[model samples]
Target chain A: MEMTVAEALVECLERENVEVVFGYPGGAVLPLYDALYHSTRIRHVLVRHEQGGVHAADGYARVSGKVGVCIATSGPGATNLVTGIANAYMDSVPLVLFTGQVPTIQIGTDAFQEVDITGITLPITKHNCLLKDPSKLAIVVKNAFHIASTGRPGPVLIDIPKDVAQARISFKYPSTVRLRGYKPTYKGHPAKINEIAKLIGKAKRPIIYAGGGVLASNASEELLKFAEAISAPVTNTFMGLAGFPGDHPLFLGMLGLHGTRYANLAITECDLLIGLGARFDDRVVMNITSFAPHATVVHIDIDPAEIGKVIATNVPLVGDVKLILKELLPLIEKVDRSEWLERIKSLKAQYPLSYNRDSGLKPQFIIEQLWNCTKGDAVIVTDVGQHQMWVAQYYHFKKPRTLVSSGGLGCMGFGLPASVGAALAAHPGCKVVLVTGDGSIQMTIQELATMMEQGLSVKIILFNNSALGMVRQLQQYYCQGRHMATHFQFHPDFEILAKAYGIPAYTFRTEEDVIKGLPEVLESPGPAFVNCIIPPEENVLPMVPIGKGISETIECE
Target chain B: MEKHTLSVLVENSPGVLTRVAGLFARRGFNIDSLAVGRTDRDDVSRMTIVVEGDKPLIEQVTKQLHKLIDVIKISNITEDEYVDRELVMIKVAAEPSQRVEIMHIAGIFRARVVDLGSKTMTFECTGNEGKINAFEESLRPYGIKELVRTGKIAMLRGSKFVALSLAQAREAESA
Candidate 1:
């Protein structure tokens, strides 16, 4: 059937089973929004800001395991999506963003509301398209989703010119995308897999370093089996948090710069480091020469480029982590490494996680309490900064894909919208908990409206310290406590904001109040907000200052 | 430690070179030399990298290269019998007295003097590694101050293999 490019876009989205779209309309996107008005199957949520729209879509994508869709007008609207797009790009979330541009004739004329969004977002997106021809809209839309959701998933942007959206074209959504340049390796070479298995058998003390790919690939079960079979202790990066059960005897807490003492010590002491779906990012490996000092690293990832980028590896397997683990599982023998396990146990006991109980409303304590109440089944999303690191260190996730947070970019204001997405995607009756800081929550506080509009029933626990706690801590350590812009004197009452958004809200100042109020908040029906006022001096511990080795961690004073 | 020719497919985007080179520099991996060019697909480019490392380390390096989002595919093609060539452009200050001698040396290397000014002559040369090295060494004494050399761009001599035709392999898998 002949249809406008804008109408074809909506039809394409419907073909992909997208029920909701998050966006704000403007001059350049008028044609697309006009088409959207006639569509009954797809619901559009108008956001307060373009950033909110992109983040809301990102949240939806993360939770649904589908490409999250967002649309915006040209110029500032497209530029506003940059930060959110970069956030998704860093975290490897699958998002398809649509931005309207001025007509093709006036592209370089700098017409009103015209911006080169594709050029601006080039670095932040996996791939992008600029559709000047109306005929290419359907194919480009289909290709954008395919690129965004496939292999190492990330955001993809499609900029549709205003005139093209108004032009008529025959619509047909392509069932599959065929791009000559983009081919992802999915299966590992059999010989390489066999070599890895042989290395596993020969290694005396092997440590498995799991990353975000474990959860992305849904390889947690296979990872656990491989660890169990080889008697290897598992450690995770921040993005990989919750990929393995923290309570598992063979599992060590997250490792690297801000990782636990036992986890870092284990990586340092192990003779073999088996990396699964984990890139050796600079945050994890402080000194290339010194990281895994005594180990021969066996790196396995779908992306071949990550294998020896940071730390030299002895064995490299390029394929899906789950697939590689499946092949390696049967070839491995189960052996009890009592000595290594004993050393790890002793280390864990000596440096056990601890915090002062004097404060009545401690963020760490509340996170633990929430974990206990939820039994680690609730999907926990966190904002960036001090609270993010604390939640990483304190919260013990017992299941894979339970903890969702910004790891690569450490983007602030990630929790609320992401929580909403998780709630929307949750198995009916599952709860989505958002652990955010006062500063981080305010950055995207407008997402509260999205939660209410969607009726997502997310529980947001805000750690209100009246300061940018992470920056404050950094100032204390590095800047001799100048305190400059870290403190915020005046702030709106979160309860009032929540009420304005038509969601139940509460505030607790004392530890006793938090203990009593947290459970009540979690049990509430629709979207609820709990603002817990924590002490400003609370600092996340076991920090490795930049350029310092993992062993040189500074514990909380 | 053996030298290997690594063929890398990278997205045709800016700063990819910086990312790839920075990765190698940070890891302290010594790269002998490198070459890059546009592939048949405008969106994708090819990079030919030469590095000396152990077999295990080379494998590890290729895997790490794959981790880079800009890098599409990486294959070690050092084992194949291929043709490798480099182009070098050298500008030497010829004192009118040394012009004939410089031309003589250029002729022996099959180099062409692309530009000639009153006091200086620019020679463009293309050859294998040893030939380029010999030409550079002979011109060094003639006041050769500045030189630009394009690193080795290699292709297999026979029509037995082509990386770009992986569509057939993909089709086989789907079938």
Candidate 2:
């Protein structure tokens, strides 16, 4: 059938089972938006800014386990999506982005609102293409989704020229994609799997270290089973939270700079560290020299580059986490590590994840209260800083894909739009909470308009410290009390901002207010916001000092 | 620092070279020299990148290079006894008096005069790094006007091509 490229693009999205797209309209994307307006198969949520659209897509992808879609025009609109695109790339979120460009004749002539977005985002994207031929749009769309969703998924961009969107093409959507250079290795070698199983069989003090790859590959159940069968304790990276159930007996809550003291201790003393889809990033590896001094590491991942990129591995298996665990399951025998279990118990008893109760309006207490109110049933999104660490520490997520935060990029302004996306994508009755800090909320404060416009239900718990809390903590420790630009000279009233957006707003500055205000915000049906005034001096403790090993973890005392 | 010659096979797609080169630039790993050209296959292009790094650093660089989707295969040819060559075409300012001396120097290096102008002479020379350096220096006194070089290209001395994975090469040997 002969149809315009814009129509075919929408049809292509429908064919891919895309249910929603978060986007903003502009001159270049008029035809595409026009097609969207006439279409019934897909719903488009108009966002206030291009960044909000991309971040919403990212959040939706993280929760929905589907390739999220977003649209923006060329030039400034496209440029605004860079941080969100980079965020998705760093965290391995699958998103297909469509950006409109000027006509081909005026491309290099620097037409109005025309920019080389593909060139600018070349390094950050998994793949990108500029649509030159209208007839090839269908195939390009197929390729973009295929590349974005497979083999360490990331964001992909397709820049459509205004004329190509208006051109007519006899369109037939390509059903399959086979590229010469693009084949992801999905199965581990049998011999290597056996070798790793052998290592697992013999170790007395073994630990199963899981990461975001477990969730990405949907191998959390396998991880739980493996950890059970082997009688090994499981610790997760900050990104790896909820990949293994936080409340499981063998679970060691997050291991990194801000990890639980016992988790750090277990890692410091373990004999064999089996890393599942976890990159040993510098944040986790306090010092390269002695990060896991006593351990022989076995790293399993889908991306071959991550296997030996940082710490050396004794057995490196490059494949999907699920397939690898499935292959390694039958060869393993459960060992009785009573002594190791006892040692771990002792470590946990000696050093627990705890905070002072006397501290005024604590962020950790608020996260715990939020967790209590939701009972681990809600999707928790957090902005970076002390609040993020507090969320990771306090929330005992019992399910995978429940704790969605920016771990790799540590991006602020993530929680608000991401929460909006999560709220829209999640099944009805599932509560979405944005646990954001004061500094972080101001970065993309414009996303509030998106929530109000869409009438989406998002409950926000703002940690209003009147400062960039995490950086302040760092300066207090590292720079000898010389505060740079970490403090806010004057903070805006977020509750008033929420009221202006027509969202219900509440503020809590004391225990009495928290008791009264939190339940009202958490239980309300429509979008709601609560600003909690936390003390300024409180910091996330049990911190592994930069450049020191996990053995030297320090507590608040 | 040790010099390592890495042969990378990539798809001949738009902005692919930029992705490959961009990875190096972003990681602060600079290539000593690089040569690129089409291979026997129409869809694939081969790049020979020479970089100086220690074992671990080079491994990181190679691993990062493989992350680019356009890159198909990579082989570090520095491990084997390989044949390496670079070609240089230099246009040297030569008067009639200096022309004979230039030709004499070029002949000793087994270089050929690819082009000649009224007062300039162009010599094409191909050899190992040492030979190319000496040849270029030999004509430097004539005041060279222009110089262009095809950076080093290398191949293993055996029948093995860099495109073959280890398992594939083993299978080929057994067959």
Model 2 residue A415 distance off true place after TM-score fit, in angstroms: 0.8
- State the number of backbone clashes in model 1: 13
Give the TM-score (vs. native) of candidate 1: 0.85
DockQ of 2: 0.34
Q: Tell me the deviation in Å of residue A299 in model 2.
A: 0.6
* Candidate 2 colliding pairs, count: 0
DockQ comparisons of all candidates to the true complex: 0.16, 0.34
Please compute the TM-score of chain B alone for each predicted structure, in the order given.
Answer: 0.86, 0.91
DockQ of 1: 0.16
Candidate 1 lDDT, A1-557, residue by residue in tens = 99999999889999988988889999889999999999999988877788888877877776667888999999999999998999998888889999999989998898988887876776678877678768878777877887788788889898988899999998877777766445778888899888888877778888999998887788989988888888889999998988899878988888887788888888889999999889988888876766888998889887766766667778888788898888888888766687888888998887776778775677888878887789887788888988888888888888876777888888898777777667666778878888899999999888888778776888888899999999998898889999989999999988998899888889988878877888888887877888888999888878778777787777755
Q: Over the stretch A72-145, how does candidate 2's per-residue lDDT look in tens digits?
A: 99889899999999999999999999999999888988889999999999978988888898888988898889
